[model samples]
Target chain A: MGKQGNYSFTGHIRPRQIRAGALRLRATFCLGGFSFLAFIVLTITGVLLLFYYQPGDRAFASLSEINSVLPYGGFLRSLHFWAGQLMVISVFLHMVRVVWSRAYRPLRELNWITGVVLFGLTVILDYSGYLLRGGQESGAAATVGQALFTSLPGGKALATVFFGQPSPLNGSTLNMFVWHVFILAGAVGFLQMFHFWRIRRGGGVRPL
Target chain B: MDLIESERPQVPVEVEQSGSQEKLPLIELQVREYIGTFLWLGLLFALTAGLKVPLDSSPKAAAISISKAPWVFGAIQWLLQRWPAWLSGWVLPLLSMSVLLTLPWWGRKVGKTWAWIIFLILSLVWVGLTFVYWSESIN
Candidate 1:
């Protein structure tokens, strides 16, 4: 009682006095943070991939050049491959942690659905990334994975937008690549923004 | 008396803090924590199966092995194999939605553990059906 303590700054004050478990919250947050890190890793490697890698053109030559000649090209490709797989894995683990905690109940349902939407986006993102390359495995993935497209009633028009014009790196494939790399950014942004908004709006899950 | 007393959440903090509360059961631990995790993982795998995400080869190469459907859709895959596509694709989704929607009421009566167990049992059946889908692949 030597000195009366000043009230916490209104700006800095968290409103609720959380005198209980913060570690769980931090752990869940760490899972999400790691997912973001994986995403960043994928993005960096993807961009580096674009430098020596031509999309849809001499698919074999471009890959061969990258593999045989470009500086750290092989490393970049491997990094992209591993990062994509890791991001998918991390996102799955993050969702599991959230659901198991019963954090997705009630007021958080919409956000939970958004989480599902984000999960779909992540799958689509990985799937689309494969298309840009469209090598043998990617080609097999595209064909056998035809179920990736939902209700392709419009078919040709949409396929062009998604797969590009199916030319020698021209038409719909490259355009699709542009959409995948750029427009998909908006969807990912929505995922993070809405996710945090719901948590802030609904407050967090009760500690176990 | 103490066990019955703990039911009232509004009990004075001192009373609620009484050290003699009963611990939850083992299945309670599993149903509550594990079911959701398993269901989601199952769904991820099931979707990969549906898309046939090429485990080994490319379009030029054919899929030589049969793959499982995503775990979430395992139930539907099950019904599709045993029942009909209309039932699996349409009716099954409706039924599952109803289960999830009514979960709170069921949870209230049966408790979360039983509710979780029931849903998990449904999920397990779904996973079983995915194997049937795998058998149909025959390549």
Candidate 2:
């Protein structure tokens, strides 16, 4: 198991060597890497938040306490918020970079599709995170989202599953809490791993 | 057979390289990543420390005159106010997403420049709408 053990999951994700051209700032602009970095920041802050955050009716109150009472709680929450916003912007920019470089063509097409899906999920995750704030604004946003979901054929059940009976005054719900923290976040994490692996398997970033 | 063919990774074209084409150890890239990570984190911390994220009015507060969507959904909310829910909320977004999802195929069919133009137009429209919504909110 000497050298063979080196061929593990981490090894596959980060190969021993890369094309030197990929190191140039102009080649990829590191937008994808930036986006992933934001994700890592968000995951750390979010888990910390989960320690004090309460879902449903206690949502807003819990957050207020975290903001005012807990040590560095507000800072952590602010970090999570900024990181979330940055991730959305960076992911969109990364997509633009991919299209600009024509990296989505041919062998990398699946990665592009995965990226698009990830983009959609990122936006939805942002929206869901907003709802978790349990403010009047969140309630309004939830209303709009629910309306969009219900407009589809057989979408009433779908809306219920996703929005989970949010009140007009407060959007936080156990249902949305699970989706935001566990389901959507988990899927993004998994897809990102697949995305990075695909890039490596495709012989690293294509040079301009 | 067709599926396998479609999934096949593209073969890299061999080109005569100058002295600069040397491959480097992954640690070099990792070092760059670490630097980038620190820089990015610095910007995030600066933003967090300088600007406070305001909490929305409490749920129990009297009904506010205006309720805004999160900035990310500002574009959709802007449209929803003017257009039918079906159009603004559902069709337009789904249509835009469909266009984005098919961009690689667009590149193949109409050429890369056209595909890039199509993507740019789509991105600008949504981003423009978001800005418009934000400006209106501020005013």
Candidate 3:
């Protein structure tokens, strides 16, 4: 068997050959592909932003500097922002498409569950990113999130673990920065790889 | 001959179909992927260049009433305004998530058409709430 026919890593990523029907634009409408594209854009732009972005008390100032001072800083920041927003939207649309095609039935059920989890994590990542802006609006948003957490039993401790100490004026905290940049984003990246692997293992995209 | 053929390993139906169907080289898919990436990147750059994402007022400034959450959380925030935190923040959202997570099981139980309907209604409710929240925030 040639490389395409083998179950090698490259083959898993893109098989040596695909059913002609699956190649049609409508087979998947490429929504999942769009989501992954947005993620790649976000990761690149996010790393660029990280060079100058500061968390905690300096967070807003660092962002302001990025917006106005650094060369092309604002453009990179805007790209990151828009990509995050687009990822959320595309993931939701992908879920809708999955349902419309009844792609979640039987053999594909596990993939659907993984997708649902990814969607939820994407929303939380967006929220956490908002908090990292270190503005009063972020402060208010953080307050609401903290309130939600605290409403649960032993919620106060959970709130501190996730939110750190955010005042009403600034929501940015070292805790949130780590979560947004490392933990949550890392989980999404790992899960996305698994999701793609599962899709390939399921005999690639089903012909429409 | 029949006995010997029966002893041969059977390819799964999906794999068999994949092999039997008219095949296209992986390059075909790669080309499409490339086109998509370029078009998507073009749109992102166009958006970035055309519209500046606004920075919030400095945190040092007097705190102003923020009646909005990020648009992604707009629906939950809208509900939070009308209902108790536990209900709006926890129960309803969790219930919706539960419904979504179990959709495959629902398909098996209620049929695919009904499952689609259930999902559509759920999605409409959340999207509708987010729009309502957006309008109110702007007003």
lDDT string for model 2 (B7-120, tens) is: 545444552254335678888888888888888889999999999997877888897755679999999999999999999998899999999999999999999999999999
Candidate number that wins on DockQ, 1 or 2: 2
List model 1 lDDT by residue over A32-52, tens digit each: 555666676666767777776
Model 3, range A74-171, lDDT digits (tens) per residue? 88999999999889999999999999988898677888999999999999999999999999999999999999999999999999999999987788
How well docked is model 1, in DockQ terms?
Answer: 0.08
Over 4 Å off, model 3: A1-7, A206-208, B1-20
lDDT of 1 at A115: 73
Task: Report, for all candidates in order, the number of backbone clashes.
Answer: 20, 0, 0
Model 1 residue runs over 4 Å out of place are A1-20, A25-29, A145-152, A165-172, A205-208, B1-139
Off by over 4 Å in 2: A1-8, A205-208, B1-20
Over B1-139, each residue of candidate 3 has an lDDT whose tens digit, in order, gives 0113443333458846665457788787888888888887898889888989998778999879875589999999999999999999999999999999999999999999999999999999999999999999998
A96-199 per-residue lDDT for model 2 (tens digits): 98899898997888899999999999999999999999988888888888888898899999999999999888899999999999999999999998998778
Error (Å) of candidate 2 at residue A38 is 0.8
Ranking by TM-score: 2, 3, 1
